[model samples]
Target chain A: MKFTYQINGAEHTLTLEKHPEGYRAHLGTAIYDVKLLHAKDGQLHFQLDETRHTAHLAHETPAKRWLHNAGRTLVIEKAATHRRGADTAGGSGRLTAPMPGQVRAVLVAVGNEVTAGQPLLLMEAMKMEIRIAAPHAGCITALHATEGGSVNKDDLLIEVEEIPT
Target chain B: MPQFDRVLIANRGEIAVRLIRACRELGLSPVAVYSEPDADALHVRLADGAVCLGPAAARESYLDMNKVIDAARQTGAQAIHPGYGFLSENAEFARRIINAGLVFIGPPPEAIEAMGDKAAARTRMQSSGVPVVPGAQDLADDTKIQQAAATIGYPLLIKAAAGGGGKGMRIVHSAADLLEGAAAARREALHAFGDDRLILEKYLTDARHIEIQILADQHGQTLHLFERECSVQRRHQKVIEEAPSPLVDESLRAKMGAAAVAAAKTVGYTNAGTVEFIVDPVTRDFYFLEMNTRLQVEHPITEAISGLDLVHWQFRIAAGEALPFQQADLTPRGHAIECRLYAEDPANGFLPATGTLLKFSTPPGPGIRVDSGVESGSVISPHYDPLLAKIIVHAADRTAALQRMQTTLQDTLALGLTTNLDFLQAILAHPVFVAGEATTHFIDQHLPNWQPAPDIPAAAIIAAALAELHSPSATTHTTASPSQDPHSPWLRLTGFRMGGGE
Candidate 1:
């Protein structure tokens, strides 16, 4: 079987085939004798060549998986054959929450003009207050965050449209 | 006075758990109080009885003194222990507990009030012959504050009089920024501590934060538990702590300890408290910072070295017990270090991350201790502190202790949500930290642009790929008998499993 996997935004082609001794697997340019002992609950215990290893994986979404191994976490995704263009182009004008938190204060209104580094809102998380600043000088076209509202990571907070000089 | 069988812990998190353990060892039943969000907290689970205070907001729960006292009454607890944060230093709370005929496992309300005000504490320290940093006190307006700032020279700090945890602190480098800085500081102080009073102090650019732990009894006995160096801070909040301070010597420690004892005596402080100081590295001069009239978050390091349980002593002292040992009999054993594990992403501006902890495995071994309030499946909410745990280690010497701490941190496994674990490891391995030269500005100066490891290792990539391939979904696509095939080469290999064999 062959598949394309995206690890940390980089894509790699991997192939696996049965061998007399375990299985022969080709990942990118390297090939190894992959002996699968067991796989369940997002944990894979296997032997690569002579070395033993365990990897934990969590299904994040249809296209994304969180892989934890070697004291580090890497987000891996099954590469999609088709690309969506609207999502990529629409991100520039939107402000998203950097982390999960509560919006303590919203300093900008829908029609407010803001500078690139002007303070836009205050977020409170982990008992610490953080000031979210505007990314660029623009007119606030939309405000999605309300005072004392909870926000998750990547939640759209506001939308700004650039003001033509 | 009544003999209390049950102690009420009017707090949440690790300190509450710590108090519960102490109470159990002391033959006292512990009753826990929790907010709605913390109904299933570890502390609550460990206690003999638990009561829900209110909602998730601290104001409605932890900081609500009446609610806490009422919970204690409802639980039939004769004594109340307010762990470090929340109402620990609230004088009114202490008074209420005492008025409710319950022993407050801490100093008297007067002592907390004296040390609670930074300006008042400085005045008391100076009068008691302790060295205090030169600055303005009790300035009524910004004009006077600016004048005082000018007299104190540039680079002075404006600190909240009623602040702890660096909530409202600002540094002014010149006259141009003094007024605005004071205004910002006042605004934050009012918001965080409910007190807008500000005090100015001479900013020591290269000073080290050293604090002496003082334990006193109602019998008028007082002793110092030496000092802990808390210089490694970010935004004036301590992240790492150890005892004794690398900057202090025999004579310096004695001097600082004496001053701390004097400060405690002047305030008639009872129970456990800490007198903080700012030490000039070059001249070895120390100035009084403020006295914390409650058990500190980093008290474990002191326990590791002294072999004494501070919380247990707090209970005993509250019960009118005398000091067990004299100043000469107590000797610190060895070096100990503590690192605060926070739910934060150091790579992304150290912002706090909130999510359910998917995996939480603590490092266990000799000379290692973990005081944690969280575990796997625990949700880190935004309404409370992000301190997940404290990883502490002790060894025969500083070098050995550092090594042990490094190994323990590396072995620690906490997945899901971002954390400062990797960032902490980087600090521990830094050359300056190894040399014991990390001052308060070490993190800001050395790692101003520090980033987490950008890429995964080759082995990890391969393992991840293989794990994905052998996932249940992928296996379902293959022949079912392949997994059980006696002739299958995979059967020849040793037992291997993925996804924890679920």
Candidate 2:
């Protein structure tokens, strides 16, 4: 079986085949004899080639794996099946919450015209106040976030229609 | 003199744990108060008794004077200890504790109020013969502000009168930006601290932030425990702190120490406090900044160098104990450095990151100390400060201390969340930091746009792949589960191993 993973915006491939003695693994252009020594409780002890390695499985999900090895932590994510469209190429015209936080204030109202780089909202997260700015000059078509309301990551907070220009 | 058999700690996280340890060592039972979300916190688990104050919002729980006092009353605690943040420096809280017939393990309420106001504190420091930064206050209108700006000249700083931690501060380098800067600063000050008053000061370029630790007793005996260099800062928040600054010689240390002692004595301060100063590196001239009426977060580095337990002394002083040693008997022995481990992304403008700590480990060795609040499986909530732990190392000299700090940070691992560990390592390796020439602008002047190394090692990739193949959620075609496949290599595995490859 073969698998593809992304780390730090770069992708790598790995293949594994069962063998009578252990397993044969192919990573990038290198092949190595791999044997699992132990695996339990989010800990994996394996021998790759002639070196023994132990990696702690910090977190695991269907699309991501967080591993800790050699005093460094790395996050490996499965390549998304469908790439996101270039919504941010020019401007998305739709603003979403970048992280979970509370809306401290709403500086703009519906139907109000805003210029690119102008602050439209204020948010409080992690004990710091963050200013949410307009991605492009546009007319506010909808406002979904209310003052003092909590929001989740990627939740749409505002929708704007670009002024014809 | 007041004697207490039980003490209630009105704080959470690492500092609370530190105080609890102190209370236990002093033969007093320690009680803990926590919010709803912090019921399972390490501090609560380690305390002799625990109470639920209120909800998770600090305003309703940790910062609520009524709730905290009630918790202490219900727990039968005779004294209350407020750690660094929260209500530690609130004068009203201390007053209420005293009115409730409970001892407040900190300075008197009068001292807290005296130094809590930055503008008022500056005036007092000047009257007490302590050198203060050239600035003007009590500007009630635009005309007064303009005049003050003219007197202070260009490149002045507009600061919030009721602020600390660098909030509501703006640096204006030209006269044209004075009014606008003051207005913006007022708005920020009102938003952050509920006060819109502003002050102007001459902005010093290339200054070092050195603070003296002062311990005072009720018997009018005060002593200074040397200095801690906290010049490495970002957005005015301290990142790394060290003891016995490399730039300070015997003569300079004596001057600063005496100034700090005088500042504390003027405020009638008792217990452990810090007097922060802004020193010009070229002339070695220092100006009084402010006096913190409570224990500071970086007290561990002072303890490392002075070989004195500050928390223990705080308890003793609050109990009306007298000093056991004279000023001539105390002297710093070695160098110490501390690196704060925060749950924030240095690559992304230092935005705080929140997640569960799936794997948490601290390095263990000689001359190393880890003061942490979280463990494996702990959740990192966004409701409070992002500080996770502090890694401090002590050695014979500055060079050896820096080397030990680098090794210690490399050995510490905190996964499932973004951290400043890599950024701290980069700072330790920087030539400017190595030469001990770093000023308060080190992060901005030297490493303004630091990013983590982009290359991922082959070993990490292999480990990730193998872990995924063995995960229970993996597809049956790729998974080699011992339950489903008896001939799988996982079934042949026997003993467990730890750590990385040699």
Off by over 4 Å in 2: A16-26, A29-54, A80-165, B190-195, B469-502
**Model 2 lDDT at residue B464:** 71
Best-matching candidate per lDDT: 2
TM-score per candidate, chains pooled: 0.80, 0.80
lDDT string for model 2 (A83-106, tens) is 133355224877888889977656
Per residue, candidate 1 scores C-alpha lDDT tens digits across B38-88 of: 999999999999999889999998989888888888889999999998899
Q: RMSD, each candidate, Å?
A: 14.5, 14.6
For candidate 2, the docking band is: incorrect
Q: Which candidate should be chosen as best, given DockQ against the real structure?
A: 2
Error of 2 at A22 (Å): 5.4
